[model samples]
Target: MTDQAIIKTGGKQYRVAVGDKLRIEKLTADVGANVDFAEVLFVGAGADARIGTPLVEGAKVNAVVRSHGRGKKLIVYKFRRRKNYRRKNGHRQPYTEVEITGISA
Candidate 1:
């Protein structure tokens, strides 16, 4: 059996294990920097699982910043049929990639 855990960050929850890479919301850290997430939602080892109320005290998940990049561009278009008005725009959301290093509970 493998050990797995769920952590919350940036208004999102991610189920991850060691050495797993994930792309999430923009974080204020440089590449190769270590970040700790204290809000653990759940953890599983073998057949036993533990859950937290909002967060578990003394529980943390550490990760290393891998890279920062912008996501795919999304086109926004607004048009009115009778008014003959049209607007077009594009947007790209910034994001950060991180690799899970260890989880302690």
Candidate 2:
């Protein structure tokens, strides 16, 4: 067992510890559903740690999906000088809220 772990999801990596809350890319899970992150890149604490070449075998990070929602809106604007062309757009990225429950290696 380790005190912290590095897990990969949604093309990103996050270093997490137990009871940590984080927002991640949208997941296909309902609120309060248990989720397991199997793509663990590293696990350990202090001087004892295990790093995987890509992913650690038999390493998993357990978490619970707390909620799903959209992030803050972002505005995108485009303009062409002397062309009278203008464009504006807004976007909100979907995300899932999760809490780290446990990490097993």
Each candidate: what lDDT? 0.90, 0.95
Off by over 4 Å in 1: none
Error of 1 at 17 (Å): 0.6
lDDT of 1 by residue, 1-105 (tens): 566889988898999999999999999999999999888988778667788887767788999999999999999999999998999999999999999999888
The prediction achieving the highest lDDT against the true structure is: 2
True lDDT of residue 100, candidate 2: 100
In terms of lDDT, the poorest run of 10 residues in model 2 is 45-54
Q: Per-residue error at 94 for model 1, in Å?
A: 0.6
Q: Against the true structure, what is every candidate's RMSD?
A: 1.3, 1.5
What TM-score do all the candidates reach, one by one?
A: 0.91, 0.95
RMSD of 2: 1.5
lDDT of 1: 0.90
Q: Write candidate 2's Cα lDDT for 1-105 as tens digits.
A: 449999999999999999999999999999999999999999988787889998888999999999999999999999999999999999999999999999999
